[model samples]
Target: MVGVPTAIAILAFEPPHGATALLALLLLAAAAAGFREPTPLWYIERGWAVLLAGGFAVSTALAPTRPILDRSLLTVAIAGATVAAMGAVRPELLVGLDWQVADQFERTLARYDFGWLGGPPAEAAVRQFAALWQALYPAMLVLASVSALAVTVYLLGRVRGEESALPPLGRFRFSEHLVWVLAAGLVLVALPVGAWADRAGGNIVTVMGGLYVLRGTAVLVWLGASVISSGWIIAAWTLAALVLYPVTMGATLVVGVSDTWLDLRSRLGVAGNKE
Candidate 1:
């Protein structure tokens, strides 16, 4: 079941379609080989994974013109965010969102008759947007993908009998060594290197920094929950996110990176608590 989605992701990522397809086929075959007496839950999960993969393909097809990697990441980001949101609000709605998004995009694009607007200014704006997208979309995709997977695993555990399949969000953290990866990217970007090096560095920093931000949020949540009610925590987070978005995100990112060394969660005194 896991191989199914893993294979789908691999096939979507790179060039050399023939090679990727062959690799995916081999993975699927191996997964099939390991299949034993299947349970109803197994079929349900398999079907869900297939549906999600199909939706990703459809969404990718519907995406606006972009580099292959950008399009793939955008599709994954959109699908993952949609899935996560649906999971939080109404898990049952998860199945239809991808199709709906693709349909909506198709309809909107069909209605768009204008080729270009504002000439040079518009072109410049678009170039800027592309640069920003290249820098940030990797992070968005990483966060969204993890959220979607966590939701899936949580739901699976709820439906079937198992120990906790997902850990408490408050306890989330990545390996500390990942900070070095982010450092290397930042160094590359700062150095008087070529454009290719800067682009690669920007992507690496964006993705790894996003992970650290998540880790920082986990520490904050754990500490906040220790002293405050959930209602207050939610209220504070909402206010900070909506009214001071830049500040909030920056603080989280900084805190997250600092926590890599400080171990803030442990120092804060509720590090051992699961909830």
Candidate 2:
């Protein structure tokens, strides 16, 4: 009756983050339909409904002539802020998250290994790689939250009599202030705090690094869009990405971080392309 999209969205996350946070948000929003007296909760419910409605109605209805991002900036921005707040308030939430991912990765790698062909490349190597990936789990959570928030906000805007829609990928960008957060995370993990070092720093660095990758992806899309309009090109790129994603992510990370100082959008004329 109400909406099932929230369930679909929550499934994208691990049980820990999904069960606790996502359900809490859903229930809170539901409460607004009858239980809550506050007006803002109504906004949350209405927004959520529109979000679940696939955004088709409002996407075409509101500001159709304007840039898709004209209204979506607020939705995405709120998502970013929500992610930052969650990381700041529950830094330790990532502690269990990392271990869960590590354990899962280790199992998958071992299952796929052919003992005759390199014999899983030593348990130490496997564990090390798992640890490295685990360090990035917190950041992954933040990225997912941003996606959820963008959809939620867009839906909210659509139903609340405000015009909003999700924007094109190329419009995404991270704020400069986050550089300091990443720097602080790196500095903390760099210190001699034994077990605590990675935990403290990983939470910040991974989240920020994920943002950099997103920013770089936007840059890539912007650059590509300049000459390539064919959707098939995207399909081909994604097909190539399955095997080359690690390499692609590495390049994206480098380019994204570099943009902090290089002012890439302006240099590439992507800024002008948008406005």
Candidate 3:
């Protein structure tokens, strides 16, 4: 919610290609989440995600031309404050997932060194791309902060057993280990962005802020999926797509199907029972 709105607002002021990319990604996410399993709750939650994503995309498409710094700073502030507050309350929410993703991304970067794939790796290319990314990183951080804050509040409400204030669905009750895995994955992807931004002399706070936004957005998308599908398996697959794209999506689907089969076997007493 925070990210979509903030992105829209920022793009409205100073349109950028990156904003379009973010908006497109969000739209794809909403469409993926909207797949049906024949439930009222599913329709409602998926509808919300789709609506929000569309709103953001349309806003970005029509965004006006303006100075990047001026447009981004305001958006970043709004997003950062929200994410920070969320994190302070629910520190465990995103940090673990962020770490995991950051680790995986680092390993991938190390192995392929795709820098060479794009012609001879040049310092100038890396520097130019890094600079552009650095400039945009702050906005990402701010949006992440908002997402973290929202998740914390949601989790805290769940912990206190305050179901009334939550969404129509109850608090997410997935395994803690799973949450940790997701958090670690998020951190893994963010590490490179953070490093690049820092080396480019981007503000550290802004960099951290963007990292959190990226983390928080991932969490929000996951939560949204969980709400829509009423099953962690679906949500997990959706999140894998959001974070790791095609590769993670494929892996998650395979794992989810296996887990589902095991669950069915256990439920039918076929796995651990004597006939």
Candidate 4:
């Protein structure tokens, strides 16, 4: 709904080359969703959300062309309501996992002028905006990383619980089969690099590592919940990580060491030799 108009507007404004990348990213996201171990109802909910978000975003982007406004409004309504519903279902996840880290990033950005490295801003307002964004980028990354780490820890804890009541890993098990597919995808994606920075570059490894960690954590949480009544605590930790990762990562960069070491150590101590 929203995305169709948005995509059309974007195509109208941007060159065809941009569409390719956008489409690829969307496809990747779709593939990732396919791998999730969700019930039919869950899938329907997720699908609708994705569609609404995509549609709204695309339509908004292309709004200048004077396309149908009612449909766009409907898309926005659906997407917004869905997000609200999600929050209602998992308020902790919404607040703990998302908002805390977002605040940290915003604060960090305020500390530094946005890092605009490119050409001169066309206007004073634009320049200020760019500067603001530049300053905020590092903080945002740190926040995102912290959030991710927290989620990972929470999931890991759940996986280790003995009496956990968490759901099964199901399609999101991150099994050998999935690993192989991911590996193959990586190799295929990386094959185009030249000698200066070959296919097996640090960037490739970094991306793959991140993916592995994310998927592994999700699976661990699922498994942990299966064996313990208190497995949901893992999800809480994940939320914490997501919120704190950005600030923590930024601190690590500034301090020249991993900021999460103490936290990780403490968590390990608590978990003990349960593995």
Candidate 5:
């Protein structure tokens, strides 16, 4: 349900199991039309999409408009709706996942930080970092939500076999345009435009750093197949990665940054985008 994301806010962090169960029934109906009833995927998607959108709106409309949830919820609702539509033809993709994701984001806004872990001796620095973390939490939520969706899409697809709602996984590649993201974040951190700008910049680094790591992993996978297909070698690399984490991460970051020009994957003739 597209609007079911707002229902997440209305339900206060835990998605209603009732709506989820109902959604499952509707999804089954849609799937049936596709596999058995000679139904157009678009027709089923259009019908249920409208129904889901209404439910989502009703839930959001009912949420208590306190402090920031009023505004942030709307923005997230829009984002969740967009994500939902991206897989409209797949019933499982409409699995009210955005609700769970919204709940996690809600909790992050409420209380997510390294406070329990503690850091630095300077009181002022600690408070400043806390404030910064709060500002960046939204961006974190976006990345986390997207990641969860990807994982869910994959896992659920596995369960459904050929009937998997989402499409198959393709080759991985980070965008060259994201290279500017790294530069912008560095500049923002180096020179504070404003508190908001600084927060955004730092969060950009966080998100983009994650992408870089993914790119690095992609490189490793490609190399595993091309350089040496030995399972033992791959296992050794994994062990090394676990043991030398910071070094591995730093190396990945470097590779990711250099990829803008290197296009290492392309050079290896692996997953080079024709586009």
Candidate 6:
């Protein structure tokens, strides 16, 4: 299910060598995921070596002029593209989700006495909001995949009676070069790209922007952690998120983008180097 769409999406971008790249990426990702949290379980203990070896084999086959790849970024792009491809192939998937959201919205509204707020205008507002939500389904799915990965990592640690090796959210950062991907996305959006390419660019911007928000928040958390207790940090963040969402997000996004250039954590002499 995942591989087919992912391969198709990659081929759309790099037809001649996409399949080989996809195979290499899958091997590398599988190896990294397994090796990061190796278990005494039979399959994991036995299979991770094979996965790593396979990844190396593929890379070697393309050696001398091996295509440069950022394993993490490519993995994420492939996952997001796969999700968007799935929606494209069977749009009813998103339609079903949209219907569920609309149904729940109506049910909630029915339970509330909107009084003057409930009218044709309110109905129109709901319709508009629903349309916006449906359009954002691709970005939502990309974020959902990240959330699911986090949950799975947490749960794996719990099931194994071990602390997760995952770094604290406060220390999160990704490659600074990823800003180029977001920039490329913006250019695509601004230009008269084909409809499909434009939509893909929109998805890229939305997903990357969401990630940078988290990275920016992490920078803030790192700053706060040095001076305040975790409880206070959490409380403050929760309050700000609830009461000043747009302001907080905008500030964080700016901070995140700045961090890429400024390398804020290192400047503060508190680079969390656990990874």
TM-score of each: 0.54, 0.54, 0.25, 0.25, 0.53, 0.61
lDDT of 1 at 19: 59
- List ranges where model 5 is wrong by over 4 Å: 1-135, 155-160, 163-170, 273-275
Predictions in order: lDDT? 0.62, 0.59, 0.42, 0.42, 0.55, 0.61
Query: Taking the tens digit of each residue's C-alpha lDDT, what string does model 3 give over 1-275?
Result: 43344333334433466745576356455545546564443553343333443443343344423222222333344434555576789997446434544454455445645465575466456556645554554345444433533443343344345775333321111222333433444455557766543433334443433333333333334445445666776667567667876565444444333332343233433332110
Candidate 6 lDDT, tens digit per residue, 19-56? 45655467446535555665343242233233322333
Off by over 4 Å in 6: 1-116, 229-237
Q: Model 5: per-residue lDDT, tens digit, 1-275?
A: 32233223224333456754455455545444445444343453444444433433444356523212222224445655665676686766534443434454456545645455563445456557655555666466656544543443333334335364432222456457767977898788779578767776887788778777767766666667678878898799889999999999988878767766888877777654311
User: Which one is best on lDDT?
Assistant: 1
Across 212-275, the per-residue lDDT of candidate 1 in tens digits comes to 7777788777777777877976787768777987887898899999987888878876554322
lDDT of 4 by residue, 137-231 (tens): 42333233333323322332343353532223321222223345345545655777664243234333333344345444433444455545664
* Model 3, CA-based lDDT: 0.42
Candidate 6, position 193, lDDT: 69
Runs of candidate 1 with Cα error greater than 4 angstroms are 1-123, 135-143, 162-164, 230-234, 272-275
For model 2, the superposed segments whose C-alpha errors exceed 4 Å read 1-138, 160-164, 272-275
Sort every candidate by TM-score, greatest first: 6, 1, 2, 5, 3, 4
Q: Residue 34 lDDT in model 5?
A: 47
Model 2 residue 265 CA deviation in Å: 2.4
Candidate 5: minimum summed lDDT over ten consecutive residues — where?
64-73
Alpha-carbon error at 245 in model 5, in Å?
Answer: 1.0
> Which portions of model 4 miss their true places by more than 4 Å?
1-170, 173-195, 198-200, 239-275
**Candidate 1 vs 4: which has more TM-score:** 1
Best by TM-score: 6
